[model samples]
Target: MENEQIKTIFEKEGITSEIQCPKAFEISEKYGVSKMEIARYCNKNNIKIRACQLGCFK
Candidate 1:
Protein backbone atom coordinates (compact mmCIF):
# COMPACT_ATOMS: atom_id res chain seq x y z
CA MET A 1 0.00 0.00 0.00
CA GLU A 2 1.07 3.55 -0.55
CA ASN A 3 2.16 5.76 2.32
CA GLU A 4 -0.93 7.92 2.02
CA GLN A 5 -3.09 4.83 1.97
CA ILE A 6 -1.38 3.58 5.08
CA LYS A 7 -1.89 6.90 6.77
CA THR A 8 -5.52 6.80 5.73
CA ILE A 9 -5.81 3.37 7.24
CA PHE A 10 -4.26 4.59 10.45
CA GLU A 11 -6.70 7.46 10.61
CA LYS A 12 -9.67 5.34 9.69
CA GLU A 13 -8.72 2.72 12.25
CA GLY A 14 -8.01 5.23 14.98
CA ILE A 15 -4.39 4.16 15.39
CA THR A 16 -2.64 7.13 16.93
CA SER A 17 0.45 5.64 18.47
CA GLU A 18 2.79 2.74 17.81
CA ILE A 19 3.00 2.12 21.56
CA GLN A 20 -0.74 1.61 21.71
CA CYS A 21 -0.85 0.10 18.21
CA PRO A 22 1.51 -2.77 18.90
CA LYS A 23 3.94 -2.62 16.00
CA ALA A 24 0.98 -1.92 13.73
CA PHE A 25 0.01 -5.57 13.70
CA GLU A 26 -3.60 -4.60 13.59
CA ILE A 27 -2.93 -2.73 10.39
CA SER A 28 -1.02 -5.67 9.03
CA GLU A 29 -3.87 -8.07 9.81
CA LYS A 30 -6.66 -5.77 8.82
CA TYR A 31 -5.05 -4.53 5.63
CA GLY A 32 -2.90 -7.50 4.79
CA VAL A 33 0.19 -5.34 4.97
CA SER A 34 3.46 -6.44 6.45
CA LYS A 35 4.78 -4.83 9.60
CA MET A 36 8.06 -4.12 7.85
CA GLU A 37 6.30 -2.00 5.25
CA ILE A 38 4.44 -0.16 7.94
CA ALA A 39 7.67 0.36 9.79
CA ARG A 40 9.27 1.84 6.69
CA TYR A 41 6.34 4.18 6.24
CA CYS A 42 6.44 5.19 9.89
CA ASN A 43 10.13 5.88 9.70
CA LYS A 44 9.88 7.88 6.49
CA ASN A 45 6.96 9.86 7.80
CA ASN A 46 8.69 10.84 11.03
CA ILE A 47 6.06 9.13 13.11
CA LYS A 48 7.16 8.37 16.64
CA ILE A 49 7.41 4.72 17.49
CA ARG A 50 7.68 3.34 20.99
CA ALA A 51 7.62 -0.08 22.58
CA CYS A 52 7.80 -1.94 19.28
CA GLN A 53 8.27 -5.61 20.01
CA LEU A 54 9.71 -6.16 16.50
CA GLY A 55 12.25 -3.36 17.07
CA CYS A 56 11.53 -1.96 13.59
CA PHE A 57 13.10 1.33 14.45
CA LYS A 58 16.17 -0.05 16.15
Candidate 2:
Protein backbone atom coordinates (compact mmCIF):
# COMPACT_ATOMS: atom_id res chain seq x y z
CA MET A 1 0.00 0.00 0.00
CA GLU A 2 0.97 3.58 -0.46
CA ASN A 3 2.36 5.61 2.41
CA GLU A 4 -0.55 8.01 2.19
CA GLN A 5 -3.01 5.15 2.53
CA ILE A 6 -1.19 3.87 5.56
CA LYS A 7 -1.15 7.32 7.00
CA THR A 8 -4.89 7.60 6.56
CA ILE A 9 -5.38 4.26 8.28
CA PHE A 10 -3.13 5.37 11.07
CA GLU A 11 -5.09 8.54 11.45
CA LYS A 12 -8.35 6.64 11.51
CA GLU A 13 -6.93 4.33 14.15
CA GLY A 14 -5.62 7.28 16.17
CA ILE A 15 -2.03 6.14 15.81
CA THR A 16 -0.05 9.29 16.04
CA SER A 17 3.29 9.05 17.79
CA GLU A 18 3.15 5.45 18.93
CA ILE A 19 1.55 2.07 18.42
CA GLN A 20 1.59 -1.27 20.23
CA CYS A 21 3.16 -4.33 18.60
CA PRO A 22 -0.04 -6.32 18.38
CA LYS A 23 -1.83 -3.39 16.88
CA ALA A 24 0.88 -3.10 14.27
CA PHE A 25 0.49 -6.77 13.48
CA GLU A 26 -3.24 -6.29 13.08
CA ILE A 27 -2.63 -3.46 10.65
CA SER A 28 -0.12 -5.57 8.77
CA GLU A 29 -2.51 -8.49 8.35
CA LYS A 30 -5.47 -6.29 7.65
CA TYR A 31 -3.58 -4.45 4.97
CA GLY A 32 -1.67 -7.45 3.62
CA VAL A 33 1.64 -5.84 4.44
CA SER A 34 4.69 -7.10 6.27
CA LYS A 35 5.49 -6.22 9.84
CA MET A 36 8.95 -5.14 8.70
CA GLU A 37 7.37 -2.72 6.26
CA ILE A 38 5.33 -1.22 9.05
CA ALA A 39 8.42 -0.98 11.19
CA ARG A 40 10.26 0.80 8.42
CA TYR A 41 7.37 3.21 7.95
CA CYS A 42 7.25 3.91 11.67
CA ASN A 43 10.97 4.45 11.74
CA LYS A 44 10.96 6.74 8.75
CA ASN A 45 8.01 8.71 10.12
CA ASN A 46 9.43 8.87 13.66
CA ILE A 47 6.59 6.89 15.12
CA LYS A 48 7.57 4.78 18.09
CA ILE A 49 6.67 1.14 18.47
CA ARG A 50 5.79 0.22 22.05
CA ALA A 51 5.27 -3.05 23.90
CA CYS A 52 6.84 -5.19 21.22
CA GLN A 53 6.03 -8.84 21.85
CA LEU A 54 9.38 -9.97 20.44
CA GLY A 55 11.35 -7.26 22.18
CA CYS A 56 12.53 -6.06 18.81
CA PHE A 57 11.39 -2.46 19.13
CA LYS A 58 11.02 -1.92 22.89
Candidate 3:
Protein backbone atom coordinates (compact mmCIF):
# COMPACT_ATOMS: atom_id res chain seq x y z
CA MET A 1 0.00 0.00 0.00
CA GLU A 2 0.97 3.61 -0.46
CA ASN A 3 2.14 5.88 2.30
CA GLU A 4 -1.05 7.89 2.17
CA GLN A 5 -3.11 4.75 2.56
CA ILE A 6 -1.03 3.67 5.51
CA LYS A 7 -1.41 7.10 7.03
CA THR A 8 -5.16 6.89 6.65
CA ILE A 9 -5.20 3.49 8.33
CA PHE A 10 -3.08 4.83 11.14
CA GLU A 11 -5.39 7.77 11.59
CA LYS A 12 -8.44 5.53 11.56
CA GLU A 13 -6.81 3.31 14.16
CA GLY A 14 -6.15 6.35 16.39
CA ILE A 15 -2.45 6.05 15.96
CA THR A 16 -0.90 9.43 16.26
CA SER A 17 2.49 8.97 17.90
CA GLU A 18 2.23 5.50 19.35
CA ILE A 19 0.82 2.12 18.37
CA GLN A 20 0.48 -1.22 20.12
CA CYS A 21 2.55 -4.18 18.97
CA PRO A 22 -0.46 -6.36 18.17
CA LYS A 23 -2.11 -3.57 16.24
CA ALA A 24 1.01 -3.14 14.19
CA PHE A 25 1.06 -6.83 13.42
CA GLU A 26 -2.61 -6.73 12.53
CA ILE A 27 -2.00 -3.92 10.12
CA SER A 28 0.92 -5.75 8.64
CA GLU A 29 -1.19 -8.84 8.06
CA LYS A 30 -4.21 -6.95 6.81
CA TYR A 31 -2.15 -4.97 4.35
CA GLY A 32 0.19 -7.78 3.41
CA VAL A 33 3.23 -5.85 4.61
CA SER A 34 6.15 -7.11 6.60
CA LYS A 35 6.48 -6.42 10.31
CA MET A 36 9.95 -5.02 9.73
CA GLU A 37 8.55 -2.64 7.15
CA ILE A 38 5.92 -1.45 9.59
CA ALA A 39 8.60 -0.98 12.22
CA ARG A 40 10.70 0.98 9.77
CA TYR A 41 7.79 3.20 8.88
CA CYS A 42 6.98 3.80 12.52
CA ASN A 43 10.59 4.58 13.25
CA LYS A 44 10.99 6.89 10.30
CA ASN A 45 7.81 8.75 11.15
CA ASN A 46 8.71 9.10 14.82
CA ILE A 47 5.81 6.86 15.82
CA LYS A 48 6.70 4.76 18.82
CA ILE A 49 5.78 1.14 19.27
CA ARG A 50 4.22 0.39 22.64
CA ALA A 51 3.49 -2.79 24.54
CA CYS A 52 5.66 -4.85 22.31
CA GLN A 53 4.95 -8.55 22.63
CA LEU A 54 8.48 -9.59 21.70
CA GLY A 55 10.26 -6.75 23.44
CA CYS A 56 11.30 -5.49 20.05
CA PHE A 57 10.40 -1.94 20.92
CA LYS A 58 10.03 0.00 24.11
Point to the candidate with the largest TM-score: 2
**lDDT of each model, Cα atoms only?**
0.72, 0.85, 0.82
* Per-prediction TM-score: 0.72, 0.84, 0.77
Determine which window of 10 residues in candidate 3 has minimal summed lDDT: 49-58
Q: List the residue pairs that clash in candidate 1.
A: none
Model 1: per-residue Cα lDDT over 1-58, one tens digit each: 7888888987887666553446377668889888778878877777766766655544
**Candidate 2 clashing pairs, residues 3+ apart or interchain:** none
Error of 1 at 5 (Å): 1.1
The global Cα lDDT (0 to 1) of model 1 is 0.72
- Give the per-residue lDDT of model 3 (tens digit) for 3-32: 677788888888999998999989888878
> Better model by TM-score, 2 or 3?
2
Of the two candidates 1 and 3, the one with more favorable lDDT, higher being better, is 3
List, residue by residue over 1-58, the lDDT tens digit for candidate 2: 6788788889988999999999998988888867877888899899999889876553
Candidate 2 is scored at a TM of 0.84
Better of 2 and 3 by lDDT: 2
Backbone clashes, candidate 3? 0
Looking at candidate 3, what is the lDDT of residue 37? 74
- TM-score, structure 1 vs. true: 0.72
